[model samples]
Target: MTRGERALLISVDAGSSVPPYEQLRGQLAEMIGDGRLPVGTRLPTVRQLAADLNLAANTVARAYRELESAGLLQTRGRHGTFVAPGRDDAMDRLHRVATDYAAEARRLGVPPAAALALVRAALDATRPG
Candidate 1:
């Protein structure tokens, strides 16, 4: 097993209610959030991971795609995917915070317009006269 995989203990329960792709995605995201999978750490190829886990390649690919979409991973063509770097500067931090909030809003079923309006109102209320 790769150091990252060994540290994260990525696994899938075939009989669990959660889908394999989602299961893999959640574990990877958790590892990334907790720093087990550090930025620039290359991931195993989709085929390789699928074979190791006894899952279809598409399952691993879906997990990787979702992570990439959520800004947790980056694919460098032939080089492969790696954990994305975390934000270090103020604006970058704010952007990450906002992205997290937006994700929460989505999970809570808040409409996109409603979520934006709420943020706007909050900002307006906090603004100096």
Candidate 2:
């Protein structure tokens, strides 16, 4: 961890419908966008985040992987993860992408229940939605 990098056990509202992984992803994205976690800021390891929140390593890893794939973070071998430069714009882009996907799903005659089921499946299969 970087100097002064206080590892915060990011809080999650138990009553919220959002999954834990999504909460993690969104919070990190927001922090990055708002400069709370500045560009190139090193992040805690997956195990560290999992331990911090009492979550499974896979959960944190999935969120980190998605963020990395979305270009919001970059992982260095054995060094750790860091915020990716120019990733602030990705949060909005991801929202648009989800909207477009939902629209397309509706256009394909996918009923609301089935659509939600697909979303649930995707969320279960990958990171959070």
Candidate 3:
């Protein structure tokens, strides 16, 4: 399916306590996590998504930025944004688990750098020689 078709499945409730950008981000992330938005899938441009959702461009931009930072999406200059390639189910599980870990770390007042360091240590420890 096309990116616009995928995006059309998402909806925003302005009355919800959750912020609009977060709602968009979560929906996009869920789609990406599933096979619905497979690797290399091209996403709508920020302005295009904003217009479709009736949100300010910055709102969509912020959601895109967050997903990009999380390595779920990548921008290719004029080519536009696309879902980052990954190992399908394995990577999706990893992303979901890592997100949960990060949330737990945040709840426990762990600093971002320290949380990442801990994750790196765990990865190194688990890596095969």
Candidate 4:
């Protein structure tokens, strides 16, 4: 999928366990860190994201506002949101988790596909069981 399309999909999953704002924050943070959404890449407007995600504009705005505060995004007056430059410490935490998971998967000879499936399943099963 194109990068923008994949991000739209992620935005649609906003109603999951973590509140939409945090999900948006975390996902955008990761995308920025991984260089998927390159620095200065224009982001969907708050209204656009809200419409696409079936969320309230205020909700999306809140997330964007938080990201701006954290330095992961910048909003140029009338120009719209753009990916901010720089690495967030959150990326280090994510890398540590990815490294640990990679090591375990290697030890177990788990295929990359299977490992990802497991992670997806875990996310899906986060609700009371």
TM-scores for all predictions:
0.64, 0.64, 0.68, 0.59
What's model 3's overall lDDT? Answer: 0.83
**Candidate 2, clashing residue pairs?**
none
- The superposed Cα distance between candidate 2 and the true structure at residue 81, in angstroms, equals 0.2
> Each candidate's lDDT (Cα)?
0.80, 0.75, 0.83, 0.73
Candidate 2's residue-wise lDDT over 36-64, tens digit each?
Answer: 77777888889988888888898899889
> Model 3 off-target regions past 4 Å?
1-7, 87-91, 97-129
Which tens-of-lDDT digit does each residue in 3-108 have in candidate 4?
4333544654644444777667666766766668777788888888888778899988998898788677889989778877775668647754865685588578
Lowest lDDT sum, 10 consecutive residues, model 2, at 1-10
Prediction 4 global C-alpha lDDT: 0.73
List, in order, the clash count of every candidate structure.
0, 0, 0, 0
Better of 1 and 2 by lDDT: 1
**Which prediction has more favorable TM-score, 1 or 2?**
1
RMSD vs true structure, all candidates? 5.9, 8.4, 5.3, 10.4
Evaluate model 3: give its TM-score. 0.68
Clashing pairs in 4: none
Candidate 3 lDDT, tens digit per residue, 1-129? 354335447899999656899879977887788668877888988999898899999999999999998889999999889988755677789877876786687679887689889989988999999
* Model 3 lDDT at residue 8: 44
**TM-score of model number 4:** 0.59
